[model samples]
Target: MSTIVIKRSQAVWQDRTRAYTAWVDGKAVGRLEHGASLSVPVGAGEHEVQMRIDWCTSPALSVSVPVGGTVELECGPNANALLALLYITLWRHRYIWLKPATTE
Candidate 1:
């Protein structure tokens, strides 16, 4: 089972549109509109974590986690450093979250 823990520092729009997207291993996984918390089934093993909202110039941010491990990402409002943005974009954001690998 793969779970994503998100902590939002801002509120959704008045229309109740969060306009956020999460990607697991380069593939979009879950979409949260009016909600802040999201849980979804993720592929086990090492995978890339990416997320971004509207008005956000930069792409998704990432980190790395172990399999079967639950990772939490906090969304804060700020302009990241130039170098960081460039590096992150190369990896398509970051290298966050690690899902458990399945054994045959």
Candidate 2:
């Protein structure tokens, strides 16, 4: 098995709404906030790792972790874009769900 560590850096903006969902092959594995760290279990081999915020998704990182080793991911600037996209997407989803009831 392999271990993965995700690290987030602080943004200058006061916004704390930024949260990233970590995915493996389009499946969500876990989530972490900006400046937070999350550890995940992985298998040895080349794996596609992704981070998504709202509707925007980060470029998939091809990571190869050795057996019983660790891989550290530094989630940086792109976080802002990721977060913005996610917020808009979620808002749309919420509107779509809530509007139907009120309109009826």
Query: Which numbered prediction scores highest in TM-score against the true structure?
Result: 2
**Model 1 per-residue lDDT tens digits across residues 1-104:** 65556544443332144445666677777765544656655545555655655423224445455567666665433334444454345543332222222235
lDDT of 2 by residue, 2-101 (tens): 8877766576762356677777756898987867877889887777777666655556777787999887776644324556555455533221110001
Model 2 residue 31 CA deviation in Å? 0.9
After TM-score superposition, what is the CA distance of residue 56 in candidate 1 from its true location, in Å?
3.3
Q: Which residue runs does candidate 2 get wrong by more than 4 Å?
A: 79-104
- Local lDDT at 85 for model 2: 53
Q: In terms of lDDT, which candidate is strongest?
A: 2
| Pairs in steric clash, model 2 | 53-86, 54-86, 55-85
> How many clashes would you count in candidate 2?
3
Worst 10 residues of 2 by lDDT: 95-104
